[model samples]
Target: MATCEADCDAAPVPLKIMPKDYVYSLLEDPQRILSPPTAVGETLGIRGSFEYFHYGCDGHQDAGWGCGYRTLQSAISWIIRRRDSSSVSVKDQHVPSIREIQQILVNIGDKGAGFEGSRDWIGTLEEFYVIDVLYQLPCRILHVKELGSAEALAQIRSYFEEYQGFIAVGGISDTASKAIIGYHCSAETGRVYLLIVDPHFASVPSCRQQLIDEGYVRWVPVDEFPAGTYNLCLILQP
Candidate 1:
């Protein structure tokens, strides 16, 4: 037997640290995580219950049946009850009120607020929640992962390319990152819009220019695009 100077057990084995790319490559396709857009109406009604109740005022009620719920809390409850009732399916139709449409807008705003305030956002939590709700199914919320600068946009683009249909909402800024703006895209319409929380105050145009220059996005004048919805592509950097 050979006499060893050190005990084999005494030396600690080094743990392998995975490179970010290797870890990223291991991730499941982002598109697979999304519920098909066919479920949008239902998901909107469910997740946006709060909006149904709050924004679906008399003006909204006059506009549609979906406007019956007059408070966000009530709308949420209604959605929950509907889910439990087993009578309503995604295909089971119900006329929504104008108020319901208004609620949708409000809910989108609320979502933006939540995203901005969240301390940890890896994109997974929101994605899972949206998928589960849309599918009328449940799933485990996994570990959160943060996207680095410009990485978020890349992720969004990948998701869109794979799914071919879905909306993407993001906080975008110029190279400086100081002048930031939020954007929302409609997959079906292929339309993208610049959202301003405060219309009285506007983001610097230079910021938008910066995003274009960096090849993070392409800018189309509002007049040319005309804003309802249009097909578009993500212009990535070389």
Candidate 2:
């Protein structure tokens, strides 16, 4: 999303498939590492599987503003590998890089195949457009006016229960964009927690456990989230 030196006019690069262990969902031991509150009642996570994408994963100079792109890339990877892919349809099968993503958006517009790259950072709304463009996939956007309210948390829980796909969560106070892959409810204290996978930083992980150790993927309390007005981009996979 920012400072990507990839050529926007060059041919699209196919997403490199990492080893199964490198993928986030395939990594075990998160249950062994977590120190969640004993007050939680139910815990839910993403249904199928997903791969992790981050700032420096693909050799881009994107450190500050590439979070939205990384988040969207991970979501697309999950859709491509989902179990119900018999019905899945997309303009392209392989994942696209930052340059390709910008190119696709420009092509769909009146840019006429001439897109000058900018340093603009994309948010959850831009992610929605990218999914619609590449996958022709319909998505849902949930606006949370209040960050930690029970009603908002309930809606998030419902989405996890029904869809079980990764969601991109952006907020007014949250400087970084995060993907919500799990949810928990504390019956005793009526508190809710979110299992978020952050796509920030430039760490080259040797294994998935490194990410967990560094807190790139973990459970965060909803109360700790930034002040209100969170936009959730939910990609609906077929």
Which of the numbered candidates is closest to the native, going by highest TM-score? 2
| Residue-by-residue lDDT tens digits, candidate 1, 1-238 | 1111111121211222121111111111111222323322212101111111222222222222221122112222233433434554433423233323233323434254343322222222232233323233332221112222133334433533443222212221210111012233445563433321111111222333333444333322123322231211111111
lDDT of 2 by residue, 1-238 (tens): 1111111223323333232223233333232345555545887767666667888676776898888888888887887777455653432366667776776657556244544365556788777766666555667777777767777777778878888877888887775888888888777876788888888858666776778788888888888877757888776764
Residue pairs clashing in model 2 are none
For all predicted structures, in order, the TM-scores are 0.23, 0.79
Q: What stretches of model 1 exceed 4 Å from their correct place? A: 1-90, 93-131, 137-148, 168-238
lDDT of 2: 0.69
CA RMSD, predictions in order: 21.0, 7.2
Q: Pick out the ten consecutive residues of candidate 1 with the lowest summed lDDT.
A: 171-180
Model 2 TM-score, all chains together: 0.79
**Which prediction has the highest lDDT against the true structure?**
2
